[model samples]
Target: MNYIWDLIIKSERAGIAKRDISFAVAEVYSPYMELSLESLNARTAERRVELNPYYRFDHIFDGMFDINNDEDVELREQLFDILIHFLADIDLTQGLNKREFYIRFALRDLENGAYGDKVMRSIGLFGREERDMIALNLLRLYETGEAVYLLKDTMRKVFKRSTIYANCEEKDELLVYVGQEETEEARAKVGLIMDIFLPVRFHVEFYWNRHFGILGLEDTMRQDGIAMY
Candidate 1:
């Protein structure tokens, strides 16, 4: 919970608007919880649900954080605090929904490390037999921006001689440009390595020295013995 508050404060210091920060938090937390603007409005307007004393926010707003309204701001803060605590207490190994479990798992991984190569490898093995594309897509979308930032940092470290620029062109596509010349094998290797770390639905495209390309994931089987992409 403190981590979430710290993130909001850090984002504010980094010049991100309050509304964007709210949306970012919503993006990560909404999927795990039954959160919707309409439901929140209705619930908060009616008799308060007594989940906890500190979590008294009626509902989360759609876009703007409404900083001008003191109650609204306070409610938003309370809602986030409530969510963080609620999510933290959920037992992932119990009878939780698979999607919720994976989303929570991925969020934990991201917070621990920005889905680095080693973390990705571990998650890949952990989820190797799982094949819920929708859940994976949600995780990928939530981490897309951070993944780009981490990818750029990784490229800077790995290819010091080359200037690397990485950007998320769409929700699911990452475009990476390497200034120096790279062989076909080198480009494929870069793409393949990143593909292994990213969500199954997300794709990475590499462009270097006028060459453009992408890597493909191998067909794999799930725990149910069904083949998956």
Candidate 2:
């Protein structure tokens, strides 16, 4: 994750434009977005909730946490604290949306320099195969439509183990907490998803503040003698 962040920041020095950085990040992290949508569908099915309700996955688009990063409310608060450090570390103009941000950053590294090269090499992620695998799974779930109906069907089959809906308003919040806290298995599932998104969250503030040219980062970098690099 540090490697990804380093590549993003170094892209500026290597002559990678902010636009490209945004594009790359979006492309690479696209799977997380798909996961968010699929997870939302799963929750709905579990609760016997109606399809295409007012609170679609898009409604919970509260940054990557809605997908990968944060956990419950407390964890989300903690993540914001971490975000502060990242904001203080980068430079830029106006931050792009999440999708745009990832693509541009990844492309920046690919086209200009190799700031992330060693790490990717170490991980054996030479091309887009790994990226595509993640992205494709999400797409497959989305297109199959089975993922959307999975929870409901499962619940009907195993009624005792299924969760009941309390209120639609707190649906997303409830789903996250209950799924993670109700059973050890669920907790592991949540943690696994969290691990998937942790890298993105670690670098989120770096993208936002730097891409948007937040004034404080320049001052912080200068104070710490980090601006020279």
User: What is the per-residue lDDT of model 1 for residues 2-116, given as tens digits with 9 covering 90 to 100?
Assistant: 2333334344344453344332233223433333233533312111121221222335333334336556666676675555444433422346677767766664664355646
Candidate 2: count of backbone clashes, pairs at least 3 residues apart or interchain: 25
Tens-digit lDDT track of model 2 for 101-208:
555555444334343443333222212333333333333444574432333333223223333222235333212112112444443333332233232312111111
Instruction: Tell me the number of clashing residue pairs for each predicted model.
Output: 1, 25
**Candidate that scores best on lDDT:** 1
Give all candidates' CA lDDT scores: 0.43, 0.32
